[model samples]
Target: MIWNENIECASRDSMSQLQTERLIRTVKRVYHDVPYYRKKMQEVGLVPEDIRTLDDLVKLPFTTKTDLRDNYPFGTFAVPMSEIVRIHASSGTTGRPTVVGYTRNDIAMWAENVTRSLCMAGVTKNDLVQVAYGYGLFTGGLGLHYGTENLGASVIPISGGNTQKQIQLLQDFGSTVICCTPSYVLHIAEVLEEMKIDASSLKLRVGIFGAEPWSENMRRDIEKKLKIKAIDIYGLSEVMGPGVSCECTHQAGMHINEDHFIPEIINPETLLPVEPGEVGELVFSTITKEGIPLLRYRTRDLTRLIYDKCECGRTLVRMEKCKGRSDDMLIIRGVNVFPSQIESVLLEMSETEPHYLIFVEREGNLDTVKVQVEVQEQFFSDEIKELQNLTKKIKYKLESTLGISVTVQLVEPKTIERSAGKAKRVIDNRKI
Candidate 1:
């Protein structure tokens, strides 16, 4: 069932050699054609030849989101505009969107990588995949669309939104595989319950979820609700869409396509490489991309890497599920909190649903956090004493886990807003 066995199962030494060769050519290409990279290399008094080995990757300057913003549009692209067959950009909530370009070869390579990822998830030509990620400027929908076709699987490019229609299609089409954000899949589960359709009525066997940091508890919830094997897939628009890495049937860690993209974990503050299996910021170098090759691009995602061979028989390095982004980490009352941590605690409890929101507010020069959680229909009783006990239990659990006292308010089912895309987990109103 392994796709592209030559690349995915290459020996460590063979892979390293392949990466070195690709890195050398990528560096030389960017050094000459891209002014941004050329200037970066010149400022460090380094040349393309200095990056002859994989270890020499440390010599190259790191590219950040700010660098992409300063460059704008196509400034970071190595090839001319005519050569770029496709363009994609981030949502750019902070400022100008980080733009990425792709040549024909880049597109082909992306399809190949995603095909490998689909195969890893146990998707085959006989499966029908329903792509629920957004299309157009966003990469998720189209990325999975072509990958499913490339894998010889029938694809339904349903895109996002239209919940009722999504459920109808899932039932009518007998989709065997689904690709979308984890949150949206949960939303689908809620809709399925509302429609009074048993999950076994359809033929869904596999769910590929990504585009957000979700917890293992959330995975279990998804599996229970949808009755499908939930697999995690990781990627970014800056590096490549949804195919950068994916979990196999083992579900241990996501196997990175190291033959095409080189991954490094570095301390966010010190900017030094961390020891293997240590939590740090994840960085990437696009060694095989042609239109816009990046050197040591800082991804800001916090995770650790595993180099041991996976039980799935793939030798590619694997990364633990991302805990959270460095920038997304919230500091409240001198304590660091990740929304995923809160999510894990909430999902572990049977009285509450996966839907919740974290609100941080400033009151009287002090920062306070209030968590709004959704209570299951059976748990939403009007008995005041019962409600009080449930709230106290949740508050105690959150305080024990987060080391900070938080107000827990239990709302009725479906009170929190549901997301059709990436879930909005945190709302910080503190004016700091």
Candidate 2:
């Protein structure tokens, strides 16, 4: 089910050559059109002419969220606002939202990538797709919507939330494909259970999930509960949203669209490329983007690369499931912990639900981490000894996995608030 066979299955050498040409042209365009990029290049003592090939990518300056924020609004845009056809932004929870713009060509490219992603997931024009990601400033909803439409598949522009409505549409519309955050899909599964709706009654066969890092265990849970092939889609609003890369039917790893966006792995601390197949920060450069072409943008996501040809026969580079973000990492007692680690532990145990929260607090110079997870309704009990044993078992497993003592609190099912977008997995009070 590979789409755009020429590009998706292109040889590594050919793809590299294509990337080199696009990278060179993108650099020249940005240098002449963007003052900020010109200044950054000048600071690095390099010009567009220096970037002769894809291998010279390391010579360019790295862009970060701060750089986009400092540039603000349209600062990083290579073209005038008149040419910008659309605008999208992050939630800006930490500060001003990192804004992104798109020219008509950029939107078409985005649509094409997403359409290819849908095909990679085995979606076709015959399947009805329901897109439940959030829209507007957030890129998930509209991104999936356009791609589904471009694929000639019937798309339900149903944005996030309205779980009851989502379920109703799933039934009435007979939607065969769903796209949303992994956590939200879990939430939908939970509601289905509560409502006593048999998943077998639905027509869903494939789910495309992203916007948050989910573990293999979580993926298994999603597949088992929903009875759908869960495919991971990777993207950031800053880097052209959800269709940047996607997993084929093989589901081994997400294939990066190297022709439009070049992918790299670098040691987050040393700021150098890591050894092949090593886990590190994920960086991207959008060579085909027009309104906002970025050079070596730091995505902060932690993942490794897989270059082997996929079973589905695509030769594009694949990125393993994201471990977590370097910045989203919690440094508790000098040991790094990612929520996905804790999530893998809980889901593997089979006694707890997928919903959980991590709370980090500083007690006198020492940092303490607490995990509040929901126990399955069948496992929840008032017996003090039984509850204590369950808590101890979970605590021990987590301590072994995270290498840090954590206070584990088991709560009743459905205790944690659910989200239709990115789940709030961590609550770091130390920042406050």
Local accuracy of candidate 1 as per-residue lDDT tens digits, 1-432: 899999899999999999999999999999999999999999999999898789999888999877887888889989889999999986432324568999999999999999999999999999999999888777888899989999999999999878888898899999999998776788789879888999988899999988766778879988998899999998988898898999999999999999989999999999999988899999999999998898899988999999999998899999999886776657554334668778777778874458889998866434689999888866667798998998999899888877668999988777788889978989988543
Native-structure RMSD, model 2: 12.0
Clashes of each: 0, 0
Q: What C-alpha lDDT, on a 0 to 100 scale, does residue 234 get in candidate 2?
A: 89
Off by over 4 Å in 2: 329-432
Candidate 1 worst ten-residue window by lDDT? 89-98
The TM-score, computed over Cα atoms with residue i paired to residue i, of candidate 2 is: 0.78
Local accuracy of candidate 2 as per-residue lDDT tens digits, 1-432: 666999998988999999999999999999999999999999979989999987899999999987998888889999989999999987332325679999999999999999999999999999999999877777888999999988899999898879999999999999999998776788789889999999989999999998766678778888999999999998988899998999999899999999999999999999999999999999999999998999999989999999999999999999998876777656453234667778778888785458899988755324579999888876677798998999999999988777669999987777888889978999987621
lDDT of 2: 0.87
Instruction: Spell out the clash pairs found in candidate 1.
Output: none
TM-score of each: 0.78, 0.78
Candidate 1 versus the native: TM-score?
0.78
Candidate 1 residue 350 C-alpha distance from true site, Å: 46
